[model samples]
Target: AQSVTQLDSQVPVFEEAPVELRCNYSSSVSVYLFWYVQYPNQGLQLLLKYLSGSTLVKSINGFEAEFNKSQTSFHLRKPSVHISDTAEYFCAVRGSGGSNYKLTFGKGTLLTVNP
Candidate 1:
């Protein structure tokens, strides 16, 4: 079994400021990690993921996350944020291999970009 935990429920940052949304997970087995973003009035979108290979993954919109095995963390970061970047961010994890559709998601962290 796996579980995810987002350290902050809300993150308020001025436009263009650097920000980081912390996420952590726990599991007895290897897992695939992901980050999902939800804009207002829209469904969640796949922001970035860490399936294998490099421990770092980046989104097209300048968001990036690094999978740290020792720390069991996959924290999202942006050097500079925009107004459009404001949204709810969710961290998720799924057990590797098999037909397991069981994915664990965090409560989510709402990013509010202020002017």
Candidate 2:
């Protein structure tokens, strides 16, 4: 079984400042990865994902996450953030193969962007 751990529960950053939310997973086998974001009262949205090929995946909203197999991590980063970027981010992992649609998610990290 694989489990994801988000190192920080909350990250506060000033507007236009860079931010990095750390995420780590523990698994002996191959897996698919994803990062989901929730804004305010809205539902969860897929920010980015990594299944195969490239280790780096970017979202349309300037957010990016790099899958590092060696360190078993998929950390999300952004060069600059806005006040609208305040939201809760979740790191999810799903085991490769089978028809399992279940995803193990981390506790989540709340990113609060300030001016």
Candidate 3:
């Protein structure tokens, strides 16, 4: 089983500033990490993921995360932010075996990008 931890419950950043959302996880088995964003009154949308290939993964909206197995961390970062980027961000992990496709998520970080 895997569990995710989001260090910060809330992050406030000014528009056009750089930001990073810290995330850590613990698991006994191989796991896949993902970041999802949830806007007000909307379902979660996949932001980025680290499954295979390069340890570094990025999303279309300029968010990137690096999978550091040693530290058991997968922190999300963006060079710049926008007010429209404000949302609840969740870090999730799922075991990579059997029929267990359940994703364990963190408490979530509410990113408030102010104008």
Give the C-alpha miss distance for residue 11 in model 3, angstroms.
0.2
- The TM-score of candidate 1 is 0.97
Candidates sorted by TM-score, best first: 1, 3, 2
How many clashing pairs does model 3 include?
A: 0
Per-prediction TM-score to the true structure, in the order listed: 0.97, 0.96, 0.97
| Backbone clash tally (model 2) | 0
Error of 1 at 75 (Å): 0.3
For model 1, the superposed segments whose C-alpha errors exceed 4 Å read: none
List the global CA lDDT of all models. 0.96, 0.95, 0.95
- Model 2 lowest lDDT segment of ten: 94-103
- The digit string of per-residue lDDT tens for model 2 on 19-110 reads 99999999867999999999888999999999999999999999999999999999999999999999999999998887766799999999
Report residue 103 deviation for candidate 1 (angstroms).
1.2
lDDT of 2: 0.95
RMSD of 1: 0.7
The local distance difference test score of model 3 is 0.95
lDDT of 1: 0.96
Q: Which ten residues in a row have the lowest lDDT in candidate 1?
A: 95-104
